[model samples]
Target: MKKKYVRLISRAAVWSPRFGGLAFLILLFSILLQRFSVIDVTVFMILIIISACCVVVSLFFAVKALYSLWVYGALGGMKALRGIIYSLTTAIPLVLFWGFWFTLPALHDVSTDIQRPPTFFRTARPSDALPLKSVLIEQAALQMSQWPEMSGRRYDGSPDRIRESVLNVLAAYDWPVIAQKKFKGEEDELYIETVAKSFYLGFISDIVIRLIDEGDTTFVDMRSASRYLPRDFGANAAFIIDFMEALDTEIALLPLSQDEK
Candidate 1:
């Protein structure tokens, strides 16, 4: 009778795909839980880190198994290939996010008016998680350098009209208004506070829009700050830009009043 032989790497390869599958499921569940508000950001982040580690471990075993098969004629080649495929598929999105973390400015808060950014009201659930004012100023400077078009807009309309347009745009974007108020002793100045969620991760962000009436013109300034991470990978700035562009289109689509025509 011939003696059976089983290589160590072959055994590892057999188990690698199982471990990779577990990691993939964990990553998916964590994201879904976070997105649906079933879990908090801190817990979600920890789970993501764990899943990422599992992916790395599985990949390591898969690579070792492949090396063993090539050098020592080990079995389990198909298993090793499956593990490698699973690990890479799970890693692509994480790798892209990590790339953004390094490439973009490290800012979670952004505003059209850096010197006097729109303030978040109590209803928006403001947090002290933000950095110091000085640090924010430095970060805002960097943001401005990168996104120079991120500045206040002046529209040839009354604050009331512009506020309507702003609200319409917000509704279109699905940002829920949490609070709104008129500036104290300044009836013409309107403040609207809203919350935005990232499309995929559902990460929450606080947004405030300030509309100041200057005769017939309204000056619009907006501020957006992430609730969880200190680095937003430009999400806040992108949010403001998209909103502004939408509002611009919305206002343009509005029919000219009898007086204007």
Candidate 2:
């Protein structure tokens, strides 16, 4: 009985990698289908369902192979160990791939200023774009407490100079610059809109960066939002962080004015 059980587990371990490969192929195909608009939401969902099932089954077999090694002690020889290791080699990537999203917030729309997010210039913005719907007081409070540094930055530079810096940073990332406008009044407002693509499904995310001249300082506000989904998986927040970091780096490299220095 013990030998038969071990044999079954060993065979499952051998097949685990193939299951993992199938899961990966499904995921890739789904992404490609979505990228070209070849698949509807139902088809995409079905792909995900099938892929997830394959990954779960692969991991189960992998774990079972490892458990077999544990149960039989060292008697199963190196074959058992090799089977578990082979199973893990394929299953780990998929497990980690799906597991990563669990760590992200379910809320998709992330903004520097929740009160007044940067407005989109497009004719048909996503419904989730800008001016978030009111939430519970506790939820609002929690967000405020969590993302205090997410607010816009005010730098000691003219609007034109600041706008140039913003453009440089956005362009560096190869984000598609959708629209840019400089509105003149008592103080100029520089508005730039961009569409950023995701790596997984090539999904489109809209981003707007606004620069308001305040004479001595330029106030920079940026908002990133996904067009399709309710959850961005922290992409918006990460986008802002990367842009801000790169912007700061770019600005710091610039020669400071005598007065500013």
Candidate 3:
């Protein structure tokens, strides 16, 4: 009878996919839990880091197994391939996240008027509300340089009309309004506070839009800040830009009065 032979690389290759698959499942579960609010952001972040480490380990073993198979005629090529594929399943999103983390500015708070950002009516927690004055003037300059188009918008309409259009745009985007204040007099500004949730991760961001009455025109300023993370990966800036564009479109679609036309 011939003796059976099994390479150590073959044994490693067989276990690689199992570890890879477990890592993938953990990544998925963490995301789902975070999205559903079952777990807090801290726990979700920790789970993600653990899953990422597992993926890296699984990939390392899978590659070594493939190298052994090619150079020393080891077995389990298919299993090694499966491990590689499984590891990549979780790796792609993590890679994209890290890419954003490195490429974008480290800013959790973004505003059209950095010097006097619109204040939130009520924060989810006291610690979550960081005063804009606390941010350095250099950071404000950096934000302006990076997002030149993020300045306030001046619309050729009354504050009331502009506020209507702004609310309509927010509703269209499904950003739920938590608090609002209507303009009563020349000294009062129209303020709307809302919360936006990320499409995929469901991360919460507090948003505030303020409309100042400037005689025949209205000046609108918006601010967005992440609830948990110190870095938002440019999410707040992107959201403000998108919301401004949508508001612009909504205002454009409004019919002109006979005197205005």
Best by lDDT: 3
Q: Report, for every candidate in turn, its global Cα lDDT versus the true structure.
A: 0.82, 0.70, 0.83
TM-score of each: 0.89, 0.68, 0.87
Q: Which 10-residue window of candidate 2 scores lowest in summed lDDT?
A: 130-139
Residues forming the 10-long window of minimal summed lDDT in candidate 1:
126-135
Better of 1 and 3 by TM-score: 1
Q: Which sections of candidate 1 miss by over 4 Å?
A: 1-9, 124-136, 185-187
Q: Let me know the TM-score candidate 2 reaches against the reference structure.
A: 0.68
Q: Rank the candidates by lDDT, best first.
A: 3, 1, 2
Better of 2 and 3 by lDDT: 3
Clashing pairs in 3: none
Give the per-residue lDDT of model 2 (tens digit) for 1-103: 4555433335655656667667777877887897776875457768877877876776676666566657754233344444444445545644664676565
The best candidate by TM-score is 1
Looking at candidate 2, what is the lDDT of residue 109? 63
Candidate 1 C-alpha RMSD relative to the actual structure: 2.6
Clashing pairs in 1: none
2 or 3, greater by TM-score: 3
